[model samples]
Target chain A: MVSVQELLKEYIDEGRIKLDPSVNHHTITVHDPCNYVRKSQMAFGDHMGDLNRWITMQCVDPSLYREMCDDPMNNFCCGAGGGAWAMPYDEERLAYGKIKADQIKATGAEIVMAPCHNCRDQIMKGLPKVHDMGNYKETLYLWELVANTLVIEPWSEEEIEKAHAARDAQFERDGIEMEEEEE
Target chain B: MAEEAKPMEIHIDRKNRKIGGIAPELADRCFTCGTCSGGCPATGLVPMEGAEGVTWDARKAIRAIVFGMEQEVVDSKWPWVCTLCGRCEYACPMGIKLMRSFRAARTLRERDKVPGPIHKGTMMNLERGNNLGIPKEDFLYLLADLGKELEEECCPGFYVPVDKEGANLIVTINSKEPFGEPDDMKFWWKIFYAAKEDWTVSSVNWEGVNWGLFSGDDPAWKEQVRRIIENARRLKVKTILYPE
Candidate 1:
């Protein structure tokens, strides 16, 4: 089960996806999701910490990227894992997330790239309300960062026709009917 | 002579000694080094209010379980407070898998007693195939609407294919996106279009977020996983892309 991160990395490496770092000229830091890093290290022996940083670095200017004090495997949880985000223990959840808030504050980055939904919600919604993160600007999903920065080359007429043909063939092979639509 | 202090008579509830059938020996190996608590962000968060000497930490919770006070651990808000992020396990000197015990503690709680919307969400996913109980028709409508918006916004020929057999990939969407941030769904579609990936979204049981994993319902977790797998197999897809 490859992550969008993995796929993005592969695409970027293969020259299929080109990222334009100037899309969002803001200081950014990556928040490592627990499952992706620490737990993954325990279970898979590969922390994927470096991979996350690699992706983040690719999306942002090198000068604008900031590293959190505790990176990856040692990174603090956003305190929303284990169903805490949906749980009734808001008070406790916020208290636990305080550690993450402080970590982000120390980084002094305008944006936090949280790959996990739970972490993104906590950092984006839960943290700033209680913590003093005046410098914090936005939280982005890693894929969102990539999507926003992608340098999409408009498809040529031939490419568009070929893609349409391919799509029609796929539908036909799958025995699915497609409504008439412009390519 | 001062009256002899009566030895603290403790009635051990053997029933609570083991959490969700997790081995007591797992807890028995604790070195009581307190490293887990030191690293644990939830150390003192849930005080089990009004209960004296009831504070939370991985070490203390393990001790409670080891001492047959597992019921107290489960009854309190401590288990819920712990995110089971595995920091305690990572820092454990004895190589104890603390998250297992914590997850087991979550299982010990009654479903209704399970905190917040997690259990309910899991049940909804089990019954209706998605959290938030969004019906299949509404989900499809949302997908089609959002796909059209995405096409107009960026991708020219992008339409989210639903249940397309023989597709290379079956992708699941987090229910939250369709419910609240529908635009977030475009991020993936934009990427898929650029890559020209052959991916199909299952109209039924297509939720990416599995609350069962969080709620400590093993069967529900497995069932949710099974549904995703079944969708992938039904579509004859080689990959099941679940970002959550």
Candidate 2:
């Protein structure tokens, strides 16, 4: 039930870790499973997109993010949560997920970010079969996104030099003067 | 004149205090707002033949239950088709528990009459410690194989240990990992590897999913949980991370 991203944020605030937000390059939209969030009544309220947005933005460019309609607790169940995927009623299950599939389709984002396993399974399986998100990538867990993007150790010498160069170039482009070095 | 609602034959089992999984006390709570039905993805989502006049949506189902039409609720395919995602229950201002009622209603049906995989999964869970009904030997083999491959790829010499005594954590795994989606398990293993987590998968009661919970079998659910706890104790692990 914990938002590990928020935990990572806490660690960052405490100066325990550094995160590189540019780790992800995919255009992403998020799916909030109903179990963890119950439409504004539970788990940080209906717009988990707020949290998801911040978290995803932390891993990738904010411009690459997309929001699905009826997000957070308002998000439709991808028809796979609640043990429905294991059930035998495939046709009905697919039908029940039409709204969810439609929502995913509407987003048109390359990757549908689903933080829960069941939701990811449902969306991954059903989106291609039931909806038309065939070429879209499989869903990704938020934790995986965070994990993949983490700056576990200090930057390499080459990385630091490149970063400084990029920073000075950006600042120069913005007509800002560099601070003098200590004597 | 407004059309009078026709009452049909049915009555509550007062001794049971509810039909299926419903609380008879909440039976009278619905205000017939159609809120549940409006939010539901399955209300009229299915075009079943006999659902013509039957009540299946949250509000209408509550109305029927309050009127003691418990049998009708039990009989509808709505219980199976509903997916039980539990949106209506949370959205209900009255705090109606629709999904559990549907699940309870599902359980009320003859065990043989329940939906296919759910019934099978529950039976398999009770009999084989997992819904996949994979024999212990085969399960172990897959774990060993995958662990060896992963160990070679990342951790070099260390394997994905199973039933390691006194490990810091005894972790359960979803059967789906070993059955349909083995690669997904790699994701978690990498994390554990990175963190140097002292965790071991159990050789028995390793299934994380409680199909018993899904199929409304209380005893089976309790038994499954108890088995995992037992495994943790036997291994003397400090923590038990239940599989999600």
Candidate 3:
């Protein structure tokens, strides 16, 4: 399996992909997938450098990044492995995912980037319940953040003006007064 | 006169007692080594309870099968509980290869006899496109509607290219998302739009989850894999990305 983190790094470092520096600087933490960390050995191996470089390339503060639990080869399962999610032991699986969710919450970062699909699913579903119960914060995928930051073609002045006109027209139709506010 | 009164003696075939044609040489190879049992997560499961039963570990189970003690091995609950994590193979000193032996024994058993709901799910997946037996039209409609909702609600201008031919990447999504949590499908669409990747979701055989792998059904597993490959081929996708 390809390491999404490494792929992200290659995209940025190799100049195949570019992200707006301002958007990329947002603080983030990565939830290492057990399959990627332990099974693929990407966390501990030379692949670690790729992730470090990728994070650095995004201009994220080094102190903001938190280490995963039992990270690298010894990382704990995100509770979705071995078809655990589909089995009769779903409660157990979610309970296990809570550990990872807790780890992400401890980072206090705005965004959590989970590369694995199972980890993403489990975290996205379980974290909100955790948050509702006052346990942990929410998690998002690494790709989501990277995608959000990509340096795509900016909207042209004409397009921006058109969008502004559309918004004003909608507000006018609703009889809502628009006021300019200072930042 | 006493001998004449003796009841007719019947001899049972002790050799036939072997379970699943277990061989004696395979049994002899096991050195009562605890390596297999030590790493096994299912060690203390029923019948193989605690340390006393540790001796009848995976290697022992294979040995009993090999020694024509099929009844003892088959009746043992150890095989059903084992997750086949390959941790035992990693920890074994003698390289006993117990999991393979157990799998062979499992294959020998009838489909109905195979343990767990996962096996049944595999059969369902083989017969239906998904383990849930979701009709193709329903699957497509669910995905299409979810994609539209994502574009309307969470992320506007997002497009989930369904059945787009000759895309750069073909992504296989797990059926769980579309079936259970349709909104979750939005996340991928958002990512794809933001990344500006040439990606398309297939209308047919797009589920990435392989139940056959979990059920130890190779043919079913291959069928699922083949479906994905065929879809990608038909679409002329350069890469088939597995989301899981």
Candidate 4:
């Protein structure tokens, strides 16, 4: 399987993508897929170092990033894998995912990037219903976050004004006072 | 209270009982080779304390069966915990189908006696045609609602067709996508749009999450498969795509 984190780093390195200013200001956490981080052994071997370097180069803080499980190579199955999702073990499956959900919540990051489909589904379902971790922080695919950050095209002044107006409108609707930030 | 209790007698059903097989013979043939256990994931799960344990290690469970100790295997928790990932079979020198045997033992148990919530989900799927039990009409409504929202907000001219006839492909989605995480449906929709594939999602039996297969309910499994196949035929779709 293609390593999504590596792909994102390569895009950033090539100047083909840039992080959204809003995202850079907010805390972001990534949930390492067991298959990618452990089974593939790429997370520790090389990808981890590369990803850390890239994040620093981008001026994004890494404190929000959480440590993965100990002995991740032999990590407990996420209960979604090996057909557990289809099996008659909802409570057990939910119980298995509790630690992962707690780990994400402890980071206090505004978003959790889940790469694998099974992990994503389990986290999305188990986190909210079982763990009662509400939808305050978004759960996104790694690619989606990278896509958001890439500076594909510079917005025209008019487009920028329109975007600001939308943001203001959202703030007004949420009853929050807005303070302009220095560029 | 002072009366002596009669001795309890155990009765064995011979006709329904399974006899021991070559597994024990093969165990006897082993020349103290550690090759099999070294590669087996379940090796540590089983108890191995002494000489008898080692001699019967390979066929210990098999010997239990041959000796009519069926409860030893049937009541064990090992079967449910095994993921059946096939790692053991691949590494075993004896090429033993330990996982297959475990699965067979699980299958022999009565439905109610089978441990796990998967069995209940399987029964639900059989009775309601989907494990999540969203009524057929409700499922259609949700699809329609999502299709409208997508077309209005994100993708113009995008439609999630339901039971459309003669479509090139029929796609089945997990019910959880519609019931719990509706936004996740957008990812697959985005992919389909990029590919520009002709496809239709069925109003009936559209869920691809087959709990029957996981719960070892063959009749329910067949019913679920039949429902999907029948729907595909009705829609005249040539191919069925099951998204992960």
Output the number of the DockQ-best candidate.
1
- Stronger candidate by lDDT (1 vs 2): 1
Cα misplacement distance, residue A45 of candidate 2 (Å): 11
> Clash number for model 4?
6
Which scores better on DockQ, 1 or 2? 1
Q: Write the per-residue lDDT of candidate 3 for residues A20-117, one digit (tens) a residue.
A: 65654445666656455443442244434236335544745565555544434333445555555555655445554555565566666565667666
For candidate 2, the chain B TM-score comes to 0.88
Task: Specify the CAPRI tier of model 3.
Answer: incorrect
Worst 10 residues of 4 chain B by lDDT: B19-28
Clashing pairs in 1: none
Provide the overall lDDT of each model, using Cα atoms, as 2-decimal numbers.
0.83, 0.69, 0.58, 0.55
Model 4, range B62-123, lDDT digits (tens) per residue? 44454466566666544454444333333346655544455555666678876656777677
Which digits, one per residue and each the tens of the lDDT, describe model 1 over residues B58-86?
88788877777778888988888889899
Tell how far residue A169 is off in model 4, in angstroms.
36
True-contact fraction per candidate equals: 0.63, 0.29, 0.11, 0.08
Chain B superposition TM-score per model:
0.93, 0.88, 0.78, 0.76
Ranking by DockQ: 1, 2, 3, 4
Q: Is candidate 2 or candidate 3 better by DockQ?
A: 2
Model 1: docking quality category: medium
Q: What is the DockQ of candidate 1?
A: 0.55
- The list of candidate 1 runs beyond 4 A from truth reads A158-183, B1-5, B11-16
* TM-score ranking from best candidate downward: 1, 2, 3, 4
Off by over 4 Å in 4: A1-183, B1-70
DockQ metric for all predictions: 0.55, 0.15, 0.13, 0.08
Flag regions of model 3 displaced more than 4 Å.
A1-10, A14-61, A64-71, A74-80, A89-183, B1-42, B45-80, B96-109, B114-117, B153-157
